[model samples]
Target: MTTQIDRLTTSGWSTCEPIAALVRSRGLPAITREYLLAEFSPETWERAEDATHALAKHFAGARFADEVEYGVLLVPDPHFLDTRRALPTELRGGDVVDERLPAGVALPATRPWQLVVSVIGSYGPSLGSYNEVTASDDFVVLGQDTRQWMTRQVWGARVLQCGATPPDCEHNERWTFTLFPGEELVDGQAESGTVLKGKVRFRLGKPNRGIGSARVAPALLIDVQ
Candidate 1:
C-alpha cells in the first residue's frame, strides 16, 4: 500500500521535504505527521495572511514553548497509555452511537475537519491558587479564511515533571482524531478527498509558588476525501 507519506514524497513539493525528513527520523515511531505536512502547500502557507497575529492568538499569552526533539514525541494516548488511535475507518466511525463521541466523529455526506492538540498547565502559590496556562494547535483553525470545518480539540496534556518538583500534580491527557472528509485547509477549491497532516507542540510556564507547567505534542491526520 502506498501510504500517504509515500504520495507526499513523490509529489516533489519542496515545502513537504521537512516532513519527509521527520518521517525518516528514527526516534519517532508514528507516521501521521507526514500526512499533514504533505497537505501543507505553498498556497496554504501564503494564505496564512496574518501569521504573527494568528500565532499570537493561538498561544494566547502562554509563555512556554516545546522543541521538536528526535521525532514527534507525544505523550501516550489518554486511554492506551502508549498506543495511538487506530488507522483508517475505525478512527473515523463505529457501529454504535455512544454518549460522547470521540473528537474525529465522522459526519454524514461531507464536512470540514480538523485535528487539534491542546496543552494545559496550572500552578498554585503555596498550594492555594494554581494559575492555569495553556497553548494549542487550534490556532491553525483561527488562521483559516474558511470557517467550515467542524473542529475538535483532540489531545491535551499537563507538563510532566521529571522529578519531585511539586507537592502535588495530575496526569495530562493526549488525544488523537481522524476528521471527516472536507476542505478545511485547501479552502474553496473543494479539497474533498484530501487528507492533511501536521503536528503542534506547546508548553506552559511555571507557577509562582507551587510548581506548575505542561506540554502537548499533537500530530493531526485528516482524510483527503
Candidate 2:
C-alpha cells in the first residue's frame, strides 16, 4: 500500500517550490520539507501559501535593513525539541536544554498543529525595529495573547546571556527563543486551535555600523477555515 507520505509527496501539493527554495537558501536541511509534507494537513499547506504570498507582496520593493535568515516550519506536534533532534546535524544549528512546559496544562490528544516561523542571523539594530517595519503589513497581526506571551515568556527567558561585556562576551554570541501559541490552556481547559509558533535566533556582536542588514522575515497570516 502506498503510504500517506508517498501519496502526499506524489499528489503535487506536498511542497511549495518557492518556499522550499527560500528554506534551502538559508541552509535548512531537506528534512524540513519532509516534515512539512508528512505532518501538515492539506489545509495547513493552503495557509502557508497564503502567508508566503502576502509576505512577498509586502516586501516587493523594500530595501532590507538587516541580515535576516528565516524559515517556515509546520509542526503537527507540540514537542519541538523532539522535532529538532530528528533533524540532520547540519540543520540542528543549536540545542535547547531544560525547557519546560506550562504546569497543569494538558495538550489535546490529537496534536494541535503549530506553524513556526523562524528568524535567525543578525538584525541591524534591534529586532523590535525590524519587526515594526516587516510585520506592519495588515496580513501579519499578532493577537493580544500571542503578543503578551512573546513579551513575558519568550523574551523573558534568555537562553544565552548577551548583555554583560558588550560584543566580546562569548555568551553574547547568540540569543534565541521559541514562541508558542499563547492561551494553549485557558480557563482550566484546552481548546483545539491552530497554534502559531515562532523561533527567533539573534546573533549579537559588534553593531553592524554602516553595514545595512538584509531582512527576510516571513510572517504567517494563518486563516484556518
Candidate 3:
C-alpha cells in the first residue's frame, strides 16, 4: 500500500471521481488495463474523456431509449400468406465455390454465418435472465422481444469479433471479445448492451446486471481510429 510516488491530486480531484472511475468500477466495456492505467493528471484525465468519446464514436452504435412500442398480440393464421412475413428461402453468393464458376454450370448458394447471442445484461428487476443460442434459427424466438428491448438498429451492438472464428462450437467459449466506450453506463442493462458474435462464456451476477465472459482476456485496447 506504500507508494512509489505521492498521489497526484488536489483535494477536489482526489475526493471527486476521476473521469474513468465509473467506467472502471461499473459496467461491461472493451476498456483494457492500458486504457485506465495512464498517469493521473489534469491533462491526462481530460485526454481520457476525449478518448472515451472517440471510442464510443468509432466502435459503438447509437442507443435508443424506447419512445415507441412495437409488438403484435395477434397471431396470424398458419395458412395465411403475408408477403412481408415470407422471405426468399435461400440467399445468393455466399460460398467459396462461386470462385470456381465454370463456363456452363451455375450454382446459387449462400450460406449464413452462424449468429449467436449470449445474454450479457438484463432487464425487469436486476439481471433478468440468461439466454444462449447457437444459431440464427433459435434466435428467431427471442429476436422480437430482444429487438424491442434493445430499441435501436445494429442491435445497439457491441461487436465481439470482426471475422474471427470461435475456438470451440460452444457459445460459452470465445476466441475474442472487445469493449468500447460508454461502457461506463450504469443503467439496468449496460452489461447486456454487449453482443457476443462468437463463442464465449457469458455469466451474470443475480439481482444486478453483470456479465463475465469466460476464457481469455486479450491485450485490451480502445481503437483510436
Candidates' C-alpha lDDT: 0.25, 0.30, 0.21
Task: Write the candidate numbers in order of decreasing lDDT.
Answer: 2, 1, 3
Better TM-score candidate (1, 3): 1
Model 3 C-alpha lDDT per residue in residues 1-225, reported as the tens digit of each score: 011112112111122333124223333222223322332234434443443333223222212111111111111111221111111222111111112212211111111111112221121111122221111122122112222222111112111121122221224233222221112222322222222332222212222322333111111111121
| Clash count per candidate | 14, 5, 10
Model number with the top TM-score:
2
Query: What would the per-residue lDDT of candidate 1 be over residues 132-162, giving only the tens digit for each residue?
Result: 1111123243434211221222221111211
lDDT of 2 by residue, 1-225 (tens): 123234223321225453334335544334334664665677766655544444445444444423333323333232322222222333323332223223312222243334433221222122333234324433243331122222112221111111111111123334322222222333332211111122222221221221222222334424232
Candidate 3 local distance difference test against the native: 0.21
In model 3, the runs with Cα more than 4 Å from the true position are 1-182, 192-225
Q: Tell me each candidate's TM-score.
A: 0.25, 0.34, 0.17
Better of 2 and 3 by TM-score: 2
